[model samples]
Target: MRHTDVVIIGGGPAGLAAAVKLWEQGIRDILILEREHHLGGILRQCIHDGFGLTRFGETLSGPEYAQRFIDQVEKYKIPYITDVTVIGLDKEKKVTAAHKEGILEIQAKAVVLAMGCRERTRGAISIPGERPAGVYTAGVAQAYMNLQNIMVGKEVIILGSGDIGMIMARRMTLEGAHVKGVFEVQPYASGLPRNVEQCLNDYGIPLKLSHTVTDIKGRDRLESVVISQVDEKMQPVPGTEKEYPCDTLILSVGLIPENELSLMAGVKLDERTKGPEVNEKHETTVPGIFAAGNVLQVHDLVDFVSMEAEELADSVAEYIKKDEKAEAEHTQGEEAEEYMADVVTDGNVSHTVPQKISGKKDIRLCMRVRRPMKNCAIQLIQGGKVIQEKKMKKAIPAEMIQIPVKAGILKEKENLEVKVIW
Candidate 1:
């Protein structure tokens, strides 16, 4: 059986960044597994610029942003295997993967999961629709248009206001396709406001909020769709049915973190994020195993994903070294689980990362609001006392909110609660 110090289970931005960080930290025995023929993950298909602004202080296309790290991985000669799909994982840190040649197994001292997330499809939302050729998820349509030379349709109507859906509205328009409009079920847009402005507004596309696609009409290919305004409960309201003729229906409803492998490894999942329940170090319930990027929670920006993965890699290096030292001495380390405390939410706050924390070091609490709010104040409460707070002019579900807290303030706190007050 093959062995390595660490095994990163994806070659996307997250996995690449983690591998580079681990190498920099002097942990050279690492392996990256990529399911695609090439690396760079989804960024290869994201041709539009506006990425890397946070990381590089300059605008770059998705592929360009990813290539920067891919170059580093190559420069350092970080080991990687392409066209490999990891099939199994366990608490023992044993990884089983399938490849063109045959099944492969590896035993690693530590594991990092960076498989990212998947788009919510038509079946996920159970959209009442016929099996038609013109219907495609926003990501699939993006791959078809950007990677493949095929254009999805000439007349398009997007069913969700997600970032990808909005971007595709512009993409299809630039490709000479007529985008009728974009309909969303929620009262507010699900995508970032900047995307809604640059992609939809700038392209002269209409975004109808509180609306949804009710039924799809077609035989072999898509012909038209039935749309209706949704009530407060998100149920389709009667007497608001409208029909629009379009050849394509694109969905960008939402994203789900890919965690099937994490589950197989006995990692506890957060019901809210549908990802692994991780501590401040990005360590899952199973020691020696960690998770980052979209596999931990869907991120709004790729730059943030890389940054989070780097942080996780730092923690993994520390874990590996600590374990080696313990092995050399034949002594078990001290248990610090008692210092861990749950990070809960109150008021309009939705969910948070580091679902729990040890308060032993400074940490960033990434979270989102349940709805839009103006003139809001985010407060971190510990043991009935306010420890840290940040005032924001506005908070929206589309944009994630991150607040930094110091360990000095959180030390000895039994629990922490985040509240967004408007």
Candidate 2:
């Protein structure tokens, strides 16, 4: 068995950032295990130039952004195990992993989970079709086209208007494919506003909202798709059915956090985010086991992922230097609280992160709305008293909204409420 002060699973941006931060904090005994042969994770396949505007203050391709972090890891001489997959974790933060070399075990004082997320496939959506050859997830299609220089098809109809789907629509168009349109089940687009404008609108690509691809028809290759509009109940309207003939179909329904190791380690998960339940510090229910990046919540940008990783690394350093007994006592005290705030969704609200709060510290509430509204007001109320309010000229579901609460606000409140009023 090997021992280390810190063990980070997955060597993507999150893991690399955590390692760098830990190194700055004077923690040297760290190990990063990556399943792939190299680092960067999904960013390696993305060759577009829109990344790193907020983080680096410059437009960079995905690989370029990853290269910046890779340089840090190399400069610090961080030890890493590539092509090693973590299979499980125990209560004591023991990590079990396997690679070509065979099974390896590591007893780590603290573990950071940055395994990232996976794309939703056709099976998850259950689109009716002949298990055809032309269907691909947006990410897979991106890898095939951008990295492998393989053309997926000449005609495409993308299902879902998420960022990946929107981006791929433009990519296919640039590659000389005829993009029929993009269909979204939700009433509003799930992608960022700039993506929708630059990727879809600028190219005259159609976006069908409140509509879904009800059926896919093909024999060997994708031939066509039948789309229909849906009502508030999400049931298809019988008369609104329309068919579009296309050679390929791309689905970007959603992303699910890779949490098998988290489950094995007995970490509590949030039902809404479909990720691990984490506090402000990004620590899970199991002490010394932390999670960040897309594993905690699906961030819209890589900049937010880096920010989360930096904060998580600080927490790990504190855990390593502090007394174990005192840490356990503090954790137990926080868990002993009975009353907690449930941030619910109303008419226009979509979902809120950090689903449960203990009212013990200052917190930032991040959320998205269900639709676009003009001249809207966001109100934070507790026990019929307004604690915070903000006005916006326009608010859309595509962008995430963040509101920070001071510790003083929680001192007098038993219940916290968030609402959108237009």
Best by TM-score: 1
lDDT top scorer: 1
- Model 2: residues with Cα > 4 Å off, grouped in runs: 324-348, 356-361, 382-384, 412-415
List model 1 lDDT by residue over 209-301, tens digit each. Answer: 999999999999999999999999999999999999989999999999999999999999999899999999999999889999999999999
TM-score of 2: 0.91
- Where does candidate 2 clash, by residue pair? none
Can you give the TM-score per candidate against the true fold?
0.98, 0.91
- The 10 consecutive residues of candidate 2 with the worst lDDT sum are 331-340
